[model samples]
Target chain A: MGISMENGLSTNKSVGKQSVLFQNPPCVLGYSSIAGKKEGEGPLGSCFDIIEEDPLAGGKSWEDAESRLQKKAAELAIQKASLQPKDIRYLIAGDLLGQLIATSFGIVDLEIPMFGVYGACSTMGESISIAAMLIDGGFADKVIALTSSHFAGAEKQFRFPLDYGNQRPLAATWTVTGSGAVILGSPKEVKKLPEDTNPTIHITGITTGKVMDYGIKDSMNMGACMAPAAADVIFHNLSDFDRKPDYYDKIITGDLGYVGADILKDIMKEKGYDISKNHMDCGVEIFSKETQDTHSGGSGCGCSAITLTGYVFKKMIQREWKKVLFVPTGALLSTVSFNEGNSVPGIAHGVVIEIME
Target chain B: MGISMENGLSTNKSVGKQSVLFQNPPCVLGYSSIAGKKEGEGPLGSCFDIIEEDPLAGGKSWEDAESRLQKKAAELAIQKASLQPKDIRYLIAGDLLGQLIATSFGIVDLEIPMFGVYGACSTMGESISIAAMLIDGGFADKVIALTSSHFAGAEKQFRFPLDYGNQRPLAATWTVTGSGAVILGSPKEVKKLPEDTNPTIHITGITTGKVMDYGIKDSMNMGACMAPAAADVIFHNLSDFDRKPDYYDKIITGDLGYVGADILKDIMKEKGYDISKNHMDCGVEIFSKETQDTHSGGSGCGCSAITLTGYVFKKMIQREWKKVLFVPTGALLSTVSFNEGNSVPGIAHGVVIEIME
Candidate 1:
């Protein structure tokens, strides 16, 4: 469908059912990823911009620590882009905390017009989609998309307290303690790369996901809960664009660990898409099963966020991976809802990022 | 600042600072407001579309009840719009719950691509702003903007359990149990009102807000916690458009009750705008101060939402109010944050609604 503006500009941005194809793709001017000590020791540890050895991040509490991490990442991203806080038109951010307290406290000091979003771990994708659309839609010149998660905070909020010494199932994934932020800009604000040899990254399109519930109720097995959602959106993204899985260099899922990764491939196979060869999961890549002993893998909003900003972007800038489909999956369940015996539904958002030559 | 599109259309949607002035405003296709028993007994009782006497809304738990309330409102709004769920391109909705369980569970059945947003109780305004922008930007033809808050559910999540029979502070505002949903559509989908005499309602502009903190720690006195934020946005909305208090038929606030209302007026007065005569609050209007015994007034995401869709929209249709600046204020505090001795910050979002000739 095409919409003709009163000014006589007819633009068709809506793609297929759930995707948006930007007419003027928004450029990723700057990006930053701050990781905790544990994530810094992971395989991709060296890619993080800042690695904080202190879990508290010099803050009073776990939530405060998470907030500090987010603030640091946001500031670094803006500084990298050579823009002040006032130059950012909007701050689209969120976390795993209730009421988005982490974001409310973290970005309050920055004082940018804010929009708090929550989609469990998929927040990074959601924020990027909204920010890109806002820029492409002629609403703003520059916008910040950010998200974070803390191990202690997520455990206290979602599962048992750390002091309780609770036992986790093999399917459980560890929440990554980190924050990632990116500054997206309009064409006018886009500057040439610091290194002329580097390729510019642009958010070309996005596919928003529907809540998919297969009636999975386990909070511990978040990957199992979120895997269906990941498969559904990946299928839709491919179908919406009428392309095969080989169209992109890589298709990455946010945190579908070892078990859920297998489930995701099975689901995709049933849907007639063979993504096995090029599929990758951030959860599986962040930690080594033999060395780290993490049952499933690393997971959280920060999982995919830092992976994309720190690792994937590096590959794209170096011309290793030219086009990528980044899909972040989220399990929608609160302690209250989980205890109430409600099913853990899942949602995933897909962002199409490609190197602009 | 104006953006010149590749299609040769130069549109200046950004107003002063944090506001956006839509070149092609989106129309409100339909709206629904569902209230609980307590709200049904209030002054705006007859205005609500449906009043569920059972706090559970026939669900087993408080969270489930709130989810059911949201589902009912969303369905009703779509039905009123003469559209199926399939017609909605996106659903921007959230509730005052951890992980937004209410929204996650409520709208899952709708099968629409979703974007969950949270701004405490100011979520209604945020959702509407996003939905309108998507429509105006040609990213979506129709979008559903929704939010809900339930007294019992909120009490459990943010305060004490209902069984505790906690003492009510005189300064405390009662959380309203209600849900409100509105379907915004592009001009191409604009249909004439059922009544030929009724004018069409359009979202003309929006003022997104920044998180404001004054170190207010009293959750019971949320009016004080949110008043400054409300004042900041109202001041910016007026300044951004270069308008005075008289420019709007009424300057309406979301849930700033008696205490916050006074504070808001005082702040605005100091800011060089005397809005004493035209200032109205949804919380103050929802209930009778003398008889209802709701200490300050009814306050929640639902407070401003229902008031707008029910009472405020009726008045606009009757020509009693031709233009309104609707601001929904939110005190950003979770039980965890409050327990941790963190300060309660606030945020508010403003939407400009006017009758189109």
Candidate 2:
């Protein structure tokens, strides 16, 4: 009855209403990214660890292809961390599939304790936030946060089939066929890291997002659907930490695409915070409009995931950016829900990653 | 780089592996359960808050009905806690639908921060484990862990349509048409509880489960598929805590029906710990085999959820059970994976709850 000290940790890290400030930040020991052929042709192709030309990758189905991508990414992540899969205590992962089929079928062989999470495209941020909390809370020594998505697989499930060959609207973004896995380790585990490598980047804080529905019914325009949520989290983080837009090198949103990015800027401006000068969207950064022919940009669980594991993580390791807020936005709607005339709801989770110099 | 104490908490609660011994356990302040009419006729029917005679609940679709169940359960939980929807910081919920439609559409009106999770039938356990962690880690002062399932909705999605009237196999369990929600709060919040209420129950510890594939390919026999994983977590909990089966008044497995219960006991027996005497399965407890026509028993996310919120919590409050080990097992497979001849993998999450005098 006296504070119930039986099993609770003695810490007061809860900052505001919906954010946590980790006392002992979990370090990103290593990360891996696997992209499909189309993603390989994108601007960040050279940044990915592996790019398989064959979407099927010898598998019989598109779902299997996605599973293979998740496996490769997880394996590569473990290998980079110089730790076996058994050394990692947990695998927090999900995919853009019903029941998280890609994750279940993909990383099943690892046999690590898993917490299957779903935040749509915001899965990467959600996974990392949960993993960091577990590590910082002393629940795990090392955890792998991973997520994946494939174009054919996502399209068939979320939209039209390939055989239909329906023309997509200009506001639609292509699902990035890729997977990304990041290994988060405790401070003790980070000390055991190889001396030859640069200083590890730590996940210092996280702000969990809520489902924000702006009454957008068009599933194709996910960017527009998700912008408000992204703006909401961005505002909360800035207010919670009492920091301005320039507090970090960049304020990155997951897959808002071109259309959603503009909407986010407008929303932020209305909140008295103008982040347009230093804002970047993973969806917009992954593809080139002139060559890729993607109508809007790239969007999926993998859009933010691969971009972070490949482009953002590398930049941090090289000290190009000291601190950044990574917010992955998700459109929470299903085909059945859309068919039933339900509006798409959006969610965005924010993670603050910084290099400990 | 000295532990990066900036914005980090100070505590170490992780014990051995795959488990966390909360130093200051989070208390379950309030809870609510809503079951369909079919469930109302079951053994624990009288314990539920609302029992709707119509499965449709005046909704247009089965999916809408499931959503209504979730919304009602969550609303009732908040009301029981003497709080409004805005008072809750986060809502962690999930279901067995594609993209978690029930949770999204159902809880959209509450507009709280949400983390949609999926562990098949084990979602209840997963959500509670996560919510407890968030509270113990000082991430949220009050968080609601909820999940739901509908017999009609699940059958249509996982099996054939109701119109087909296809005969189900003996091993297939009936999906419970219900929803359960538990509000977990920090100690400070628990002190504000109604004076006449009994002492709050606390989540003492948790052991996360790994996906264990025993090469089970039959989805209908979910108990058989999930038994091994259930055994793995049970054994880990016993080993990690160094306690025998008698350590708790009841060792509850979520919904491994008649067949799966035997499998779990057998698996535990092989590990030198026999739980045969104290074991009770929620699936088997909710129904009277002779009267309820449910083949094996009740199963689904709601099966364990409603059982805990309705029957189990009541017993704990009455001091009928001093301690409990609630392990919810999930068969991690999808219709697409099953059709592709893939084997089903199983997972289980264990949470230890106790009442302190």
Candidate 3:
């Protein structure tokens, strides 16, 4: 017979198997956000830790620019946590680039144990969930979860180059050039911190998402492609926890722009739950249409990541919000797959964060 | 205050804070492997579950052929375990292609909750480690860890297309066109199996690897690029567990091939432990020098995956070996990064598997 563990917390916090309710949630020790010029001009500009005016960020290429964003964000997060690079046991990171080049090149200097994950635009949520699991399961004491996306880099790889200047559809979303990093510490580790520190935000639970293919093949319209997946995860998270829309102070989605947000509301309405009143999307909140001229809004692995690190995280710390359900959605498709006539599939992961002050 | 319980096992199986020694390891219920024509003619040819003589495998493109390999392997693995698609709670998969298209397009029909991962050739070890952790942590009852790689597809993406006919260096390893899948189940789930089934292999522990860069810039020689990392992980595993090389019947490196195997031995020797006698590389064992033109032997995500599923696993089942250390090494460098003059970083994860009978 195998050994069984009740440990510090029972391992039976799973709700309906898709979600894990962490009995001893991991504390968010610190977080950092780095955004590009366009993102700096957006409404959440003042909240970012670093606003890089040069798209290249003094790097030789756009890919290298993204690497700089990741590096700065990670370094700043660790610094803010009053910890050195050696104190981190693991680094869970990813990016929108092929093979996660930005993350590999960015954090190579840290030399921490790395777990590279891919969830398209939803990588931030996936990274955070895995890092929390490692800490909650007692495998790690301190871990950092980070992701990044560069507009020029993603455009060159996934779509026409900047020189092409191809006109995008009205439903298309702009890839955010930014990076976000959050440091999660175990309770024992957090207890060693200074008593004058701010109250910590806890990741109480996570809902893993499945790839949902609604047979949408539009590569340009990522919001539409990811709406179904966002709806599915939102619906499942509520049903699994037996919660309603009002259970959370704010229900946040990664990128579903205005169009996709409406679509998600309709999808939820058909499922007997209406989330319209308390719904907010990072993509829609990031940019003001009148000034930004972004057709649909911002969408990328960095979109929700920076928003969380910059906006929601600060709100929770200031007691403006008690609880929030953060869902990051991803459109899982490659240019090759789209060129091959395959439809796009989408995925979304949900993380429940709460402040107990 | 956190909830505390001391029920069965302690959630503190960590060794030296770098590895996890599972108190209740997950069982390997079943595994399957599918290989291409070239691999079929290799030394371990007869051990594979299926061998597709045609490289195309009746598909329109090489990518589709790789997808077929994944589908066939997954189906056969589940069949061998007497389980259905619905029984699997998650599918952890990856490949050598950009964006993991081979895996996404390959296993989309299964509709399992997928955690797309990328560690290049070391993806197999990463996938298995995550799946085992999930099972041991009580997050899922059953999960399938799978990965694939195709020579043509990889060459076209990372190097030159098949039509280019580029001459490769002597140190260049051949990418193995194959796929492997392993079904991991919790103890309670495995206990429900029929009594007449063969003995199950248990994943007792895992040592997660960190990205190690030795400033190796030559992308063509992946074995040399990955050797330092292989040595780093092997050293850490030994130091963490306080065990010698003789602890297991064999210590297998994923795709170190002939050159890297020697380098790994020398590195281990300098660390005051000699692993020369017990070390075996999947890349070297998979192909015969005289028969196959693979200069340094086979290399790819499939190399170690198929070797583990087809060869080493059979030996463990028959009690030929009571225990083995499976280490898959990855060279993390994209063509874009390489072209930009970035050095290749390597990573290696060690998984200890033992027969529980």
The lDDT for every candidate, in the order shown, is 0.90, 0.87, 0.86
Model 2 lDDT at residue B329: 82
Clash totals in order: 0, 11, 2
Write one digit per residue (lDDT tens) for candidate 2, span A1-357. Answer: 011211122346766556678888888887889998988998999998898899897788999999999999999988887788878877999988989999988888998888999999999999999899888877777889999999999998999999998998999999999999999888776555554234378999888898888899999899999999999999988877778999889899999999999999999999999999889999999999989989889999999999999999888878889899999999996988899888998999999999886
Per-residue error at A136 for model 3, in Å?
A: 1.4
Q: State residue B252's C-alpha deviation in candidate 1, in Å.
A: 0.6
User: C-alpha displacement of B324 in model 1, angstroms?
Assistant: 0.3
Rank ordering of all candidates by TM-score, starting from the highest: 1, 2, 3
* Alpha-carbon deviation at B298 in model 2, angstroms: 0.3
Label model 1 with its docking quality class. medium
For candidate 1, what is the recovered fraction of reference interface contacts? 0.70
Query: Which run of 10 residues does model 1 chain A get worst, by summed lDDT?
Result: A1-10
Candidate 1: residue A37 lDDT (0-100): 92
For every model shown, what is its TM-score relative to the native structure? 0.96, 0.95, 0.95
Docking quality category of candidate 2 according to DockQ thresholds: acceptable
lDDT of 1 by residue, B32-120 (tens): 99999989999999989999999899999888899999999999988888778988999999989889999999999999999999998
What are the per-model C-alpha RMSD values against the true structure? 3.3, 4.5, 4.4
TM-score of chain A of each: 0.96, 0.95, 0.95
lDDT tens digits by residue: candidate 3, A17-125:
4677886888898899999999999999999989999999999999999999999999999888888887788899988888889988899898887888899999999
Highest-scoring model, lDDT:
1
The numbered model that scores best in TM-score is 1
